[model samples]
Target: MIAMTALAGPPADTLWATSLRRWNALCWVLFAMMAVGLATMDGPAGSRYTALALLGSVVLCYAVLDRFPDNPAIRPHVYLSVLAVALGGLAYLRSNYAALFMVTLPHYWMFGRTPRASMGFLGLATVGTVAGSVLRQDGWTVEFFSETVVSTLIVVAVGVLIGLWAHSVVAQSTERARLIVELEQTQAQLSEAHQRQGAADERERLAREIHDTLAQGFASIIVLAEAARAGLDSDTARSAQQLRSIESTARENLAEARELVGSAHRPGQTAAGSVARTLRRTLNRFTEDTGLTVDAELTDLVCDQQTRIALLRCTQESLANVRKHARASTVGVVLTRQAHGVELEITDDGTGFVVEESTGFGLDGMRKRLAELGGRLTVTSSVGDGTRVLALIPMAFEAPGEGEAER
Candidate 1:
């Protein structure tokens, strides 16, 4: 397998650049042989001139290509090999440049070529090398030609053998590149999964810590404070009622905190009744705790369990926000089942503040919860005006038979 990290190039160019470099290096070896032939030729003057002219043209093409290695136009062109083959064919007509031709064989199989091209080049190179050798010898004699052909066959066969080996190397490099990309993608997925698992673990850990420490302490303080506030009937006790009210408020906050921590890992809904009953119970509890009146018009809501839980949690969040921010006397809530879906609206005659681009996490969390079940929430409010929150949750209609079958 090819190890790209051990090679040299820009990161994106590694695969093709490395293969092209190897191809160019092999082509240069053929250039060296042609140079040697031009330097020392013992053939007849006419043969020598023809050989030099053909070989020189090949050399000039090589130089042009060498000057522009980064040129995309020249990168994968097989015209270089085609020109060399033409030169070799003409040189065989006069002399023999068959050995120089064999050195050019490696460039064809080096990289980014189809097997069919490789096969065709094998046949072309083999034929050119053998024919060049036969033409170099003056032989109408069968024995001389037979010996020349046998030797040429051995040389060309060896070239094919080595070319096959280099082809295997290119194949390995290609596969190694594919596996490297697969490994990177798999590692990324594993990293994301590990992060998600770690976050979940930390959430569970934080929940446990709150339940064990803050929750227990708050529960104890709330019981003691409740008893203390109830026993106060004297005016002296009533004078401290404001302080006691603060204590009870802290306890109620602790109650809300406990509910959150306790249900941190509860997979599904906590509501046990129809949407109307759950809303009425939540409103009643809000009234008893904060001493504010809430008028609700509710009806049966047909939704999945998760949607039901989402509505209940959003209600709790809205009421909790009102208790903390709204210093008003009355609130209104309405839930109705329409033909398309279910809608819930909560409005309050509170000292509402200006709505800014950034809302607190309370409102954002409610929006996200409803959005998950194909639901949407819209909040409308302004300074000193009332706040209204409307939620629309979509559910697909199921046939009566399908519901009965599931049951």
Candidate 2:
């Protein structure tokens, strides 16, 4: 016998484990009743005692096997053999105890491990019980065959049909349970993947916001500070003006940083003045800081918040690029209300390079921002030539009244 402490009990199938428990209880009840009958029933003392011992041995073997059902050392076939012998002996010892053989039929199906194996054991038990009864009789009598053999065959046939049906049901139920567990695991994995993608998209958005706002501001400060330092001795009045521009750029950068941290505005959306007014203000600031001449033709236009913000950001990014890369003396900004949409164009007479070779983030960010609002950006430039950036956004609103003049 294996040590009880090392055994993990029965299988993990809840339905099978529960059925085994109930089967065990039924076996115990039958054993107790048989033991009481054998103790008091009229029979030869030695035969009755021998039959009682066999019955007790059968119950004890079953109890030990049930206690460590998964133990490798204890084989189920050995128990079935013992049970067959006990049923045959009981039939021979007392004809009244023959019902025990019928009651033990389910044990074959439960422990046989397969339908074929269980049917083999059931046949063995049936033949043994009948042979024992015949050997104790005078001859092959008609009454005995009719009363015992026929009834036992009928009971065996019914048990076989019931066992096969039960096995089919259990197999289907186990398959369904496995599929349900796999489905839940798949759903959890998909949910985790979506969350990771959302986080990645949010990070890309924040990078664009910084590139368009605070980063541009800080670059302006650096340029103004350099100019102020260089002209400090020779051009005192000009140096003072450059220092003031640096201070103003730093304050604007601070505000932009606060807005980013607070998440005050949705990406690509802002609450600002009219589109023309905003562009004019940005152009005026650029002219002041760079000492470059700016010719502006901006018309007051009514549009949605997103459209206005997109146009303003394009102008700002264009001016910043001009300040850093363009060595041009004059810049031109044109804003017009078209038939179906609005357009803003910025042209600079700068030392330009090929458009295809340029891989700056500002131009791409501007394109993406406009694309989100169903707008488009076009850039035309080449070596030794100037650059032109045109942004067009489709809208359905009528142009503002003629009283609203160009800025």
Candidate 3:
């Protein structure tokens, strides 16, 4: 933690300013005491000289205190106590200038900075006032002592009030800073949640569109191919083989459409279904139509609905790309879960293209979707070499049966 320095910045409530004002008031009171000493003195030469000295002292003290408000060492109580003790002794020696002892009361205001220092100054001032009054032969009567005691009590009371007020100001400033930090953290969390919600909504919308359009179109194609196969003559073997190919393509498209819709609709619907099952079903349909062998190694690991869906989507899109562009005979899919997160790797021994040079919407869209879920997609490929796609997502598990299970 950084230590707070007096010169770091001014307190928001002008605490230092208030302190300076109190010091200035004390200086003026000291000047008043000097004026009283001068006006009441019996000798003109001594009175004028004392008044000039007191006036100069008051001016110098005020200048120093006012100019260095943020100085850690320049405490108000210390300055006032030194002034009071020195002047109190001088008044006692001059016996006739006893009225100058009134300058001690301002020491009460100085005690606001350090309680212990203020208490020490208060004790000194009380003692000096009594000694000066008595040494000046001011009758040392009960009435005189009573009056001095009353003045000391009043000054200490005022000092206590000012000290409490300063402490309260510091506490309020600390609380304000703490609250600001909490508010910023809350805002950041809210922004992330909003972004996640937006992506989820978009995925649902796209899934609905594909289900209504592409899925239905594939179903129609499958029905027509079946009708063609049934009506074809046995002699037209070549034509029948072509129709079977068309039927296989229609079935593959229908499976893909169903998987896309399932991913969007059942986002968090994790049950006994394993990643391997989902990947196999998707790859089988792809290979049946495209005749590309998919080699896969999938471990049994329970994942949350979102993680499973994201992994499945990564696999589907990757293999789809291989079929369309890789021109390779074999592809591989691997799934592994570690302490930190789950990883999905898809590699195709196809004719690979430069990752940076390839500008395909499918790859970019897959990356964006993963990123929204705090996952990342990395692609490594070049001309002639196989392309590899890796997806990694951080995992945080809730207790089984905690939230509404996805349908």
Candidate 4:
């Protein structure tokens, strides 16, 4: 009875707290009503104080809930049906608000006990209700007994059904709230994953651009600086020429870096100079700077501007790796025409790395550039042996005197 009234109105923080407050209030209020009503009435002390004694039983039952210890050896639900049965026995002595209180008392049974125990408690309350009605009567008759019993049974049946349905609704609402919380957590994790993936993709794009332009440019500068150092005392003109080359490479590197990151500056037209002559000059300058001997066989091959650029970039990257890691005194350079395509092979007799062990971004950049143009790179190396880099590009051969090549 107290548990039902314990439910709060709109002001309480939660339903459970309201129920507790209402339950505590109802127990004391019923005790006070019995105390005041019996005392004020023209009744014998036994009848007057006896009602307080009856209500005191209920107060004792409430004390179990009201002053429950923080950590209990036994669960509260285990004894709740026992408390309900005791309260029903006391409500029988006098027909107070406790009789009407039996209507919603099924809620506590349903909450604290299983279905069978709850049904059993309802039956107990029903018996108490019938007995209390019989006690209040002036005389006993079958007609009066049958009418009251049948009507009370009907009301109890309705109240039990309502309690079961209410419990079902609360259970479903709790489960739905749990599912909503899980879905929100999943969405937050998915959003964070997308953010991380986007960041990784941007980093990879920047790495490719840097490997192609800045890394190659820096390698050239190192070689030229070494050359200038060698020529400082012997030949001023050669040193001056090396310095000029260094400056030119730096400026070009800046321009390429800017363009790679999205600038309006595009690289100048390469068709104005023979691609063969440009490669030859770059290789000669590389040999002059490093004092490395080169036995070269060159042939004029026609290809698109993009192919030419890719080939140049690949060659620069390959040579840069050799200059940085190779301790070889002699290197091999070969460019030749296959039946339907061109191949550039650069081999060095230096300490080579195991192919499977090497995972440099420079190699990945070279592979990406070739893959873009339907070209391929093949590397062969083993520890203590020389490394060989081969770039093969399938392209239509342009005839001599053709002003521009098709992309």
- Alpha carbon lDDT of each predicted model: 0.64, 0.80, 0.64, 0.67
lDDT of 1 by residue, 1-49 (tens): 1222222223466777677657655657656675556546675677666
Q: Give the clashing residue pairs of candidate 4, or none.
A: 6-19, 6-22
- Cα-based RMSD of candidate 2: 5.9
Better of 2 and 3 by lDDT: 2
Scored by TM-score, the top model is 2
Q: Which wins on TM-score, candidate 1 or candidate 4? A: 4
Compute the lDDT of residue 389 as modeled in candidate 1.
Answer: 89
Ranking by TM-score: 2, 4, 1, 3
Which residue pairs in candidate 1 have backbone atoms (N, alpha carbon, C) closer than 3 angstroms, thus clashing? none
lDDT of 4 by residue, 1-407 (tens): 45543222222458767667676567657655755574446556675565556556555554565567344654545445544554454444544534444434645553444556666667766776576567655457888567766777877787677666655665666677688789999999999999999797568766776777797888789888998999999999999988988998899789978767662244444353344554676677667656776655556666666777777777778777777888766777777777758787888888888888888877888887888778899999987898999988887665675333211
Tens digits of per-residue lDDT for model 3 on 106-143? 34433344556655666676567557657765666777
Cα RMSD of all models vs. native, in order, equals: 12.0, 5.9, 12.7, 8.4
Worst 10 residues of 3 by lDDT: 1-10
The better-scoring model by TM-score among 1 and 2 is 2
TM-score of each: 0.50, 0.74, 0.41, 0.56
Candidate 1, after superposition: displacement of residue 396 in Å?
A: 4.0
lDDT of 4 at 273: 33
Tens digits of lDDT, candidate 2, 1-407: 01111112334678866765776676567666866586458778888788878888887888888888899999888899899988888777777667877667767877787788988988888888888788777579899999988988898788787767656655666676688789989899999999999887678767888988888888988898999999999999999998998888888889878878877455555543578777777777798899999999887887777788789889889999889888888999998888868899999999987889889999999999989889899999876788999999997765447226475
